[model samples]
Target: MAQNKQKRGPMQFLQFGVIGFANAAIDIGTLNLLLLLFHTDAKGLLLLYNTIAYTLAVANSYYWNVIITFKRSAEGSNRQRILFIVQGLVSLGVNNLIFLGVNELLQLIGINNWLQYNVAKGMAMFLSFLASFFMVKYVVFRDYGKRYIDEKN
Candidate 1:
């Protein structure tokens, strides 16, 4: 008989990647649509546009990760959702920092202006994805030996 085993380590990362691919598509699609609509360069308003796109994709990622990646949910789904959103906001900050850093590096080399926002965003998302996976695993969805830990006596 074969025992049922759950994903761990690299497998976890792989699962995250699958969901991340979907998220990336949503993010890039929204970004490009916004750019086409407003004609804004992916420069000064890049972070703003990217954050908007990321926010939408994040909702998709949260549910998928909970159902597929983590294979668990918090006692109260609402609490879990709020926590997930908090984690996402933090990851967004990390992503923006990385994206800006990558952009600066490309700038130092010149011709970076020719590069699209997706270039730096791709790298940033990878880093943020790693961070997010860990955050969701160890923090957001940890089984703390309680269903709903009551805060009031």
Candidate 2:
């Protein structure tokens, strides 16, 4: 006898990708807008802008990923929410560090600030997506000990 396996379909991946794009847009758009409004050279201001934008994007991604992207695979209770939030914060820190580092490197290389900002944001988005996806798959929406028992029974 063959056992049943849950396979993720193309549509599922598409939906997740769409949600990821939306979250990335929100994050980058807000950061760019803030940069435009604030012409100050203060490092704190940049960090503040990134924090605000990242928080909003993370919240949006969490809800959408839970309700849409990984809905079929998600088996955890609200207990996973804390872990999700912690993982998000950690990802945010990593992303912000990379973004700032890239932006500074571009500036040092004489690239225009506007173009540098966009490039940095794009790079950060790609890196953060990889980090977040693995965290969500393994920690947030992991199987709740049911699969092994079911397989044996």
Candidate 3:
């Protein structure tokens, strides 16, 4: 798959990072909204809220990453979509694990609060952002020649 990484410029990575900031806002905002509304720090509830927020941000990520970041001309074939979703699930796993793990550590350190929660969430987002970028670039939007269903076709 390394060969599929064409001579793309670092500018694309910068774009991905910019888009990632938007995604992070969506993710953190949604999670905070849920936490504020529910007023609970329970483990299961936090996981559920985090999942909802992460999923929403991922949907936005898929759209912008395809149209702007990668700048693909494909008509978004089912295969490509499936690949994107698969990578998303994997990234979600990465995110959730980091979140829960960090949250647990903060709890052990007796620092449970809004700031602590966000500290965990931020770490999760940053790591998973890197994972998602590479997966989308090398796997989902890799050069597949005529396999892509171009709109002009």
Q: Rate the local accuracy (lDDT) of all candidates.
A: 0.76, 0.79, 0.86
Instruction: Write model 3 residue lDDT over 1-153, tens digit each, in one string.
Output: 223434354767888899899999999999999999996878899999999999999999888878887775335889989999999999999999999999989988999679878999999999999998888877888866633543235
lDDT of 3: 0.86
Return the TM-score for candidate 2, rounded to 2 decimals: 0.85
TM-score of 1: 0.79
Highest-lDDT candidate:
3
- Poorest 10 consecutive residues of model 1 by lDDT? 1-10
Model 2 residue 24 distance off true place after TM-score fit, in angstroms: 1.0
- Pairs with backbone N, CA or C atoms under 3 Å apart (clashes), candidate 2: none
Q: Which parts of model 1 are misplaced by more than 4 Å?
A: 1-7, 74-76, 112-116, 146-153
Which 10 successive residues of model 2 have the least lDDT summed?
A: 1-10
From the highest lDDT down, the ranking of the candidates is 3, 2, 1
Query: By descending TM-score, how would the candidates be arranged?
Result: 3, 2, 1
